[model samples]
Target chain A: AQSVTQPDIHITVSEGASLELRCNYSYGATPYLFWYVQSPGQGLQLLLKYFSGDTLVQGIKGFEAEFKRSQSSFNLRKPSVHWSDAAEYFCAVGALSNTGKLIFGQGTTLQVKP
Target chain B: VTQSSRYLVKRTGEKVFLECVQDMDHENMFWYRQDPGMGLKLIYYSVGAGITDKGEVPNGYNVSRSTTEDFPLRLELAAPSQTSVYFCASSSDRNTEAFFGQGTRLTVV
Candidate 1:
């Protein structure tokens, strides 16, 4: 079965600190990977997606993710965190076909400190 | 802008209604449930105007397509576990990016 995993349940970082959120996935073929963020009582916003090409992909709000095929990981990183960056982050893997269904990992909640 | 409501509070055994309409001529519509400490799980989905499919969990929820422009999810009997945020998303098969609604937080006591 295809699945996505976010090892961290909660992470705390000081504002302006570098942040990294870990994610791993299980799939048979080259998979479509995505990162999404959801604020309190809001819907999810797409951060970035990796389909093919360069291992590193840049997303909105100064967020970037590195796709390591050998490690089966696509970890999200930010050079410096902002207070508003505090939100629930999710990692997802899209199905091979156009099922429009994504397998999501248990989310990681980031708490930014001032 | 797409506006998703903040929350919906309802009591157990009461019917809860959720409506989603997309201005975009999207062919795919989906409903997902989210809870603290967990990722979003797909509840139900509709491919086109009249095609609907139940997702991983569909025991307590029912969905319908009134038209190509309207898709609503209905919960006949609510439970404590049903108290979570529900998201509606729409997208065409050509566009991989799915557009999401603001989401409704349904609380069943």
Candidate 2:
């Protein structure tokens, strides 16, 4: 089965500090990858994704991810963290994708210390 | 707009649990998984339609398609994986994305 791994369990960054979240995946071939954010009392939102083309993909809310196939990793980054950026981030892989199932990572909770 | 909604029975603030889609296509899903660390992968989905959407909420899950009917979500919480299952799709391309639910739950027993 294809799967995703998020190394960072929890991260505490200053409101103005930079941020990065790591995600690793196990699959037979290059698979569809995604990053989502979940805030308190909210739903999971799409941050960015890496499927093909540019190794660096930009997304909403000033977020971006660099896909390093050599490392089997797609990392999310933001130049500066914001207080509102505090949330749980997830790295996911589309598995049984032909079947439409999405395998998600354990998730990384981000805490912004103002 | 009258959007679709998903429901279940969950506590205050726990992670996990997901939701629904369609087998007709290969996208979208609804989940109601629970238990230890990760829980059961509930509500697996692939979009049954063609539309594109990002998450409307932080913990919620949703998606859209470009050429088919996509998997939208309506969530409450999470339930057991033994409950029900149907309509799940999965397809991937450069700009295409997957589908998911915010998850619905009702922890009993």
Candidate 3:
């Protein structure tokens, strides 16, 4: 079965500091990976996705993710974190058979400290 | 106005309805839409009007796609465990990114 795992449950970083959130996925074939961010009491917003192509993918809000086939990981990164950047992040694996069907990771809550 | 934004309260054992509508002319619609609690689990999804599929967790829930614009989820017996935020999303096709609604927070007591 295809699944996603976010190892960090909560992470705190100082404003302007670099950030990296780890994500690992389990799938039998080439995977379609995605990263989503959710503000408090709001719906999720797509940050980035990796379908096929370059390993490094850029997304909205200055976010970027790298898909490493060898490790089965699609980790999200941002050079500088802002106060407004704090949000819950989720990594997901899209089922190849079912286009939109996704298996999501538990989630990592990011807190920005000044 | 935020899409699919609402707060609902229902008593246990009561039948509950959660409605979602999209104006984007999307071909796919999903329910139990996003992450809350354990993570976002798909309860049901529809490829098109009158074409729906059960997802990861579908027991005690029923869904219908009445039209291209509407897809509603029905909880046969509302339970406290059912208290969670529900999201709705739609996408143009298999390869395209999906658009999400603000979400509906449902509390069953």
Q: Which prediction has the highest TM-score against the true structure?
A: 3
* Model 1: per-residue Cα lDDT over A1-114, one tens digit each: 888999999999999999999999999998888899988867889999888999999999999999999999999999999999999999998865576777789999999999
Per-model TM-score versus the true fold: 0.93, 0.66, 0.95
The alpha-carbon deviation from the true structure for residue A26 of candidate 1, after best TM-score superposition, in angstroms, is: 0.9
RMSD of 1: 1.7
Across A1-114, the per-residue lDDT of candidate 3 in tens digits comes to 888999999999999999999999999998888899999988889999888999999999999999999998999999999999999999988876765777789999999999
* First chain TM-score for all predictions: 0.98, 0.96, 0.97
Model 2 segments more than 4 A misplaced: B1-95, B99-102
Off by over 4 Å in 1: B1-5
Q: Determine the C-alpha RMSD for candidate 3 after optimal superposition of all C-alphas.
A: 1.6
Task: Give per-residue CA lDDT, model 3, range B40-84, as digits (tens).
Answer: 888899999999999988888899987999988899999888888
**By DockQ, is 2 or 3 better?**
3
Question: Per-residue alpha-carbon lDDT of model 2 for A21-96, expressed as tens digits?
Answer: 9999888887788898877544567788877899999999999999998898999999999899998888877664
Q: What shift in Å separates residue B47 of candidate 3 from its native position after superposition? A: 0.7
Instruction: Please give me the DockQ of candidate 1 compared with the native complex.
Output: 0.60
Native contacts recovered, in order, as a fraction for each? 0.49, 0.17, 0.45
Docking class of 1: medium
